[model samples]
Target: MQDFLLHGILAISAIHMAHCNPDKREKYATISARHQNIALSQFSPGLTEIGENNADAYVLHAICIFLVNTYSIANPQGPITSRDVAQSFILLQGIRSILALPFAHRYIFNGPLARWLYQGSVEPAVGGNYSSKIDDLLNLTRSMAPSDDTLTCQSALEGLKHTFAAVSTPQHRKGLVWRWAVSLPQSFLELMSQNHPMALVILMYYAALVYAFERNMWYLTGWGSNVASALDKAIQEPWREWIQWPLRCIREGVDIRQVEPLKPVEGNPRTQLPTINFNLGLFKPSEPPP
Candidate 1:
């Protein structure tokens, strides 16, 4: 397992070096290929062993998989292929399953690996400006769904809040956004699969968050905008209004709050919801909304 992890890390480094110095691409290409082969050989047995009794090892293994996927999709040699996206989703789903285990939280919270993978507490900042927005979204979602689905909705909303907080923070931490991208609870994916309005709204908001990182990170180029565009097209009327602000923000490369707030319609539940805002600064090179 340790050997696989080491190879995964080395593969990531080689890929990054290749990205930075095209002249050495052939050298790094050879290095990345060798490390990737070794990691792939041990991947299955390593995961099986970790699954037996070591939650820490399991999470570490997941991170290594994430790093490898990051390198593949971000490689400048070509456009991101459909296979790359599919593979990332598969690996991310695997991580989510490991996290679902009862002991997973302990490893994520206090384990030595926590410093690298965990994003602090799940608790949102109380009384923070964005808290109100998240709360409103949660409340609205609960109102839309059955009581049994409330937990799922709340969990998804909280995940969105976490993503917002991570992206809003000043630094560009690679794992932060990637964690959110992959770690979303299974319930969230189910809601998305069903095309639930609340779910689409939450996803659109996340898309906007992704857009904010577009200019700054090589790995994230076009990802944010692509997600926003896809969601905007996927969501239909009434709900379309819910995502308009985010879509507009991404299109204009401005913060969502900077877009003109949507007007509330009398007797319309959607319009009554407050505009979502992130107090965190926008990704660099973005102009203030007009």
Candidate 2:
């Protein structure tokens, strides 16, 4: 299973590179197809193993499938479709479900894979006064979703901080966004469902972080930009002001931290943020699927 995962990663990397260099697309596409087939074929057995008591391996399998799905939509040959976008969300949900398993945290946190998924068990110091920025966002969330459970809001804030630390660091890593995505408490998702302005705003900043490091990898190309745009469009007035900085960062191709902080709207009363279709495909490729 590990070997299959490794091959899938390599094949995806090759596909990204091939996408960048059009000359190799045909050859790498064939190779990628083979890898995808092999990975998919093994997926059932690997899943069965986890179901049959080898539960410790669940994370590994989830990560493997996650990589496969990521590359599939990122393939340069065509634009991602709504179906692809839906599949991406399903894949992420599967990974999140595994991570949420009671016994899974011990293995995920202690195992070597943790290094790839998280910076460490202890929170790393983020550069600048970012904590304040995070706090502001959290406070906004509280104001926006007054009914949201306090504990869940706090967990979401911590997850945001963790993602900020990972992205703000000089070193770029894949899966940081995924880690943050899975770590978000259910309450956070509830906020998103309600189109909480603060929730969308935080996601915009996260998208900016993803955009900042996009140049380092082929798979990350366009992801941040798409997410930022979608969120910007989905959000409405007063709340929209909160995301201007991140949206500007996306448009200007600058780090979001370099942008000025959002000024608080002094007289604004808490109002329900208008919801949009806001599906997983909002960040998926805009072009037709291959």
Candidate 3:
């Protein structure tokens, strides 16, 4: 398991060197590809039969996969396609699957990893100044006329508001914002996969969050402007109105602390966030799996 993590770290380091060390860039880039391939090859098999003991390994492997791909897609000259953002979130969701493993909390509380284990505990805020912005997007989804995709779109947006609320507090962790996708349904992932306009709009919000928090990262650079630009082209006329703020954020780099979070829609339980229990603070059972 550590071997996979080591390969992933090496791959990421080499890519950084490739970009920064121009003279040896080609050599470093080639080394990165080689290590990335090996790490990913190890990851694909690990996903199939995840158990308590192996769950930690899966989580580490997924992080490697996520970082490797994010770096691979980054291009100072190229656009960050909607597919890139969508695929990144998809990889993020893979981390949640590991937490869902039975009795996961035992491992969840490990030192340094504890915050991630319990981050799901925070719910979307009720009636905050910035929450109205999230509300507007929800209303826009409703105004567009209800469809099967509505709930998934709403859910994805709702998750964003929840994340906004989480990050607003002093307890916020560095990678915590990425957890917004952890609650997404397969249906929502499908919508993003389809490049549906509404889904793309939600992705724009994600782009803003990443831009606000992660723009300094080499792989994450330009994600904001590129995602906004791609969405600008991918989304048609009327839909443009809903994405204004995200575009503004991409253009102006708005402080996320001041942004409105989306409140759960009144009377809509589906939009309401509940405390997510990853089974933290539990002891591993003495008996092994049968």
Per-model lDDT:
0.57, 0.57, 0.65
Clashing pairs in 1: none
lDDT of 1 at 9: 76
RMSD (CA, Å), each prediction? 11.9, 9.7, 10.1
Best by lDDT: 3
Give the CA lDDT, 0 to 100, for residue 103 in model 2.
Answer: 58
Winning model by TM-score: 3
lDDT of 2 by residue, 1-290 (tens): 46556565665665665566667666766776676566556555555344423443555655555654554543323433333333454555666555545555556666666676545543565555455667776776566545645556667677878776666555646556565665655456666656666666776767766776677766656667665555766788887776766676667666654554444222211111111111232121121212
**How would you encode candidate 1's per-residue C-alpha lDDT over 24-84 as one tens digit per residue?**
7678767877886776676665554544346766566566556555544433233433323
Candidate number with the higher TM-score (1 or 3): 3
Compose the digit string of candidate 3's lDDT tens values, residues 1-290.
45667787887788778767767766887788788677666656655666667666667667666665665444433444665556666666667656655666466556446665576567667775447767888998888777789977888888888788887778677676667766677677667768888888888777777777755676655555566667778888777887776666556656545654333122111111111111111111122233
Residue 13 Cα positional deviation in candidate 1, in Å, after optimal superposition: 2.9
Residue 280 deviation, candidate 2, in Å?
A: 11
**Each model's TM-score, in the order given?**
0.62, 0.65, 0.79
Report how far off residue 118 is in candidate 3 (Å). 2.9
